[model samples]
Target: MTQWVFDLGNSRMKCAPLQEDGRLGDVRALGYGDDVAGALDGAIPAAVTGEAASAVLASVASPARTAAAVDWLTRRFGCISIVRTQPTLAGVRIAYADPARLGVDRFLALLAAHARGTRAWLVVGVGTAVTIDLLDAQGRHHGGRIAPSPRLMREALQQAAAQLPAHGGDYLEFAADTRDALASGCEGAALGLIERSLAQAEQRLGERPALLLHGGGAGELASHLDHAMLAPSLVLEGVALWARLGADG
Candidate 1:
């Protein structure tokens, strides 16, 4: 059976099928276009499916849009998708007091970490916002925090002050000049927030979690994070892990 998993982010929906070796088959990014379902349309992308796999999983960045995307995939792919929830999949047990409040992206990132590494893992997703979630040594979900990202800071400055150039999340080098200052201002804000959050969390938790970074801006964050592994297909990774385990039951 073909194993397929999809991750729908704000700007694009990404899919990764399972190869014979069990790694992600091929990575396909479908940008949001006319049809909300267009996020899944492409050259069969992987082995085209008449029916979705025995199981399917999805991680939607925006909670409000999750239902529509979930329905769209189930209709198009002919599979019932497991939306990350309080209990989540049968694989990882979430101990977060308020599991519903957990971001599906962060939750999935934690699962991805569990699949590949030891416990006491930290998953960082860098996008419109930055999320840092901790999975204890026993794989229990310890919850995490979210803060403004570089783009968020830039947008705030653009709104509050005039004459500041609006820059989206771009990997660019700025010399120590006015342009750099603005860039620094935006990135600095995000940096400061993450640094303090990580430091404090480590102190309180008493064990530093392995840092796993993912998202559109994951590359940009690797250089800044002391210990980070760039996980481009994290959402997909989580989806794949859940679906595989679900099919067993």
Candidate 2:
């Protein structure tokens, strides 16, 4: 039975404790904060039985943000945290330049999708930022692009301009009131950004890759996303895949 899984995401810090018989599990989201190592050092032990699997595979948006978390994991596990640098973990080989520069989360999602044996995919992670990564039918990660998250754009609009009042989401329709309107508009903006990116990807790839969306805000945008299949845990699945692969290697 797999033990524990941890993901220090772009926004919140989350961990899950798996059962002995492989019956799925419960995830705990430790609220976000400034100190990655300090926050994670404190949270990781209490969540996992300390003796649980020390191998933590993390995906970080910022290299610096990931470093501190890796440092903390090192102290506890005595095993260096394996920061995912592309070129595949399970079956997804990153074919982008400076392969290590790819986001660990995105690669892991691609890895997880590949393990499920999908021939191709447009792995989209929606959180503080929305990234659209592509993998060809041959299970190779082509590359990806990043854009301001719909929420961040909305917040930026509201914060920079007083009247907007900071709103964001996946609502496709216009709303009746001011706040709701801002929210809906934000969603519209996100939709447009993703739609165009997907369109371009489809054009280049010659088909609609299986669309997978993961991250904190994925729930809000998943339904409205033109994507037929969506799972918030793609990253976790990838993490799980990464762990299994590491064990095998």
Candidate 3:
């Protein structure tokens, strides 16, 4: 049977084929719109829609959206596994006092990073929210922080002050116009948080951790970060590992 993994984030859903070697194949992302069911039906290949396939899901979306996805997948795949945040999984140990409170997406990202190697890592996810997580060399999570992403920040500003446009402009030290200022402020805030987190992680680990960037907004911040590696499918990669380990055990 073909195995698939789905990661449902706040804004979109990412799905990929899980190879026999426990790696991810081509990933497909579909944004959540008015007709999520229709979008899923159209995006998923017909061959993979039958009971012959299996699926694993890691979701950080609303319960309603998750339910909608689950309802659809139930009719398509034979078996489905929904991932939850565990205190410890594989070799990674989560730091959350209440593991269930931690977002599954962040937890999965940690899993993928630790599986890669025994190096301290700073995983930054730039999507609906900018999430920064630190993983030690021994696969121990050092907590994390979440803040409004640049896009969200802009939107919030626009909502609060109708004069501000929710999009456009460039990042500058000192923006000449309102559009540029909004972009600069929002991007600068996220950048500052990332930099601060990196410094704190370095101090706590006694060594600089490798920066791993992911999510839709990562591209905007990647150029500013030195030695940052982009791992767009980190969450899906973790889902594959989770499924593989589950099958093995």
Candidate 1 residue-wise lDDT, 43-78, digit = tens: 344346657453365655555566666666566565
- Per-residue CA lDDT of model 2 for 105-199, tens digit only, reads 77777877776666677777888888888887778777778888777888788778987777533253758777777778777776777777778
Give the Cα error of residue 165 in candidate 2, in Å. Answer: 0.6
TM-score of each: 0.82, 0.81, 0.97
Off by over 4 Å in 2: 1-3, 18-24, 35-53, 61-68, 78-80, 168-176, 247-249
C-alpha positional error of residue 143 in candidate 1 after TM-score superposition, expressed in Å: 2.0
Kindly indicate the candidate among 2 and 3 with the higher TM-score: 3
Q: Mark the 10 consecutive residues where model 3 has the least summed lDDT.
A: 32-41
Which lDDT values do the candidates have, in the order given? 0.69, 0.69, 0.90
Candidate 3 stretches greater than 4 Å from native: 247-249
Best by lDDT: 3
lDDT of 3: 0.90
Assess candidate 3 and give its TM-score to the true structure: 0.97
